[model samples]
Target: MTTNEPRPAMTMRQIREGLGHIEPGQPDPIVQTTGYTVSCLPEDHDERWTYTVRVSYRGDGLWSVQCRSQYVDADGKRSPGFCWSRGPQEPATQAEMDDFDAEQAEWLKAYRFDHVTALRIAKQLAPTLTYRGRTVADALAEPVA
Candidate 1:
């Protein structure tokens, strides 16, 4: 005969690394942040910056998403720049959790929507944009119209 035991809460690093299951009191794993170049800029344009959406599990049962911008350097390094964040709000009920999930999805979708638009633009302007390139399109991992 074996007795069931409660597992320990995951550490932030463990959660971020996806090393374990999240228990009730443990924070949810953070989604990896992805950076996107502004669609309006030319592929080789100087002063181009990357925009990113970040979702984090703030401790104490709270979660938040941040919209951030970073300057890309000549060598492709990024500067720690600016952001706008919403919520460290705790969802205390199943309904609230569902709402939080929906809201988070919307925020992530909004960040990615620009890439889809850019792809459509690229497809339409293909010959003219023959030499231009995109990095964010791979992040979507699906073809878009």
Candidate 2:
């Protein structure tokens, strides 16, 4: 398909289906859906999936956003990528939390990126925000332990 082709925006159901696989050390029983970003892996191999989302507690408490990434191999094995803070920088005040929540809702409502956008975010965030798949050449160059 041409790069310019418009793909349908991912539905809430689809997004929910691909999210927050509890990697050890990740908070559980309460990953807030919020919004997410995604990307496909390197070209020569079977397609792998990479996704990132902001999560927080569902109940009353301090509100903060933790950036979490999920990596799914071509065969669908789940692996942890990395996690970091997104906004409010933690120890958020009630006012900050309210503002962040409002801004986030607006941002999510206005933009739902397609594969192209996801790919861009993935490429840019690689080595920092998300897991990267090894390329064919790299695999061959390294000795298998």
Candidate 3:
């Protein structure tokens, strides 16, 4: 197939049918539909399919699903969605979270203000404003030289 050919659009039922075997975390009672619509390009032309995954969650909180796989096939075309096989679960560890936080903190350092510049800007913007119970000017007042 050429890389520019357009594939037929997939039906919603066909999309959900692929999700029958997926269960994320504990079996949640509510069912929600997550969809995927993708474009595929072949060596010359493209044939594509839109695959989707629907998940059920308990009817009272944030609805989410974690999966290992992320794609499905329809009409010989491929699309990405939730598609996970039950297997050895890789638990997200605290060290990973800590590393993420440390990276974020380092990234945020670029946005931290220089005391003198921040104080000057704050004074010009709102001389008497109290940002969080303390006056903005007082909070940013110059250090004794």
RMSD of each: 15.2, 18.2, 25.4
Best by TM-score: 2
Per-residue C-alpha lDDT of model 1 across residues 1-145, encoded as one tens digit per residue: 8769978997675775575455445655578434322233345534122323333433333233332432222223333332223344344455654654555644433322243443343233222211135444442333433
Q: TM-score rank, highest first?
A: 2, 1, 3
For all candidates in order, the CA lDDT equals 0.38, 0.38, 0.31
Model 3 gets an lDDT of 0.31
Per-residue alpha-carbon lDDT of model 3 for 11-65, expressed as tens digits?
Answer: 5555555676443343436865432222111222211111112222212221222
Model 1, CA-based lDDT: 0.38
> Would you estimate the TM-scores of all the predictions?
0.20, 0.22, 0.16
Q: 1-145, model 2: which lDDT tens digit per residue?
A: 5598789998555565567444435433665543333333333423223233332332343122223433332222333432223532322445644544554544322322343443444344433333366543444345544
Indicate whether candidate 1 or candidate 3 has the larger lDDT: 1
Q: Which residues of candidate 3, in runs, are more than 4 Å off?
A: 1-98, 101-107, 127-145
Error of 3 at 73 (Å): 47
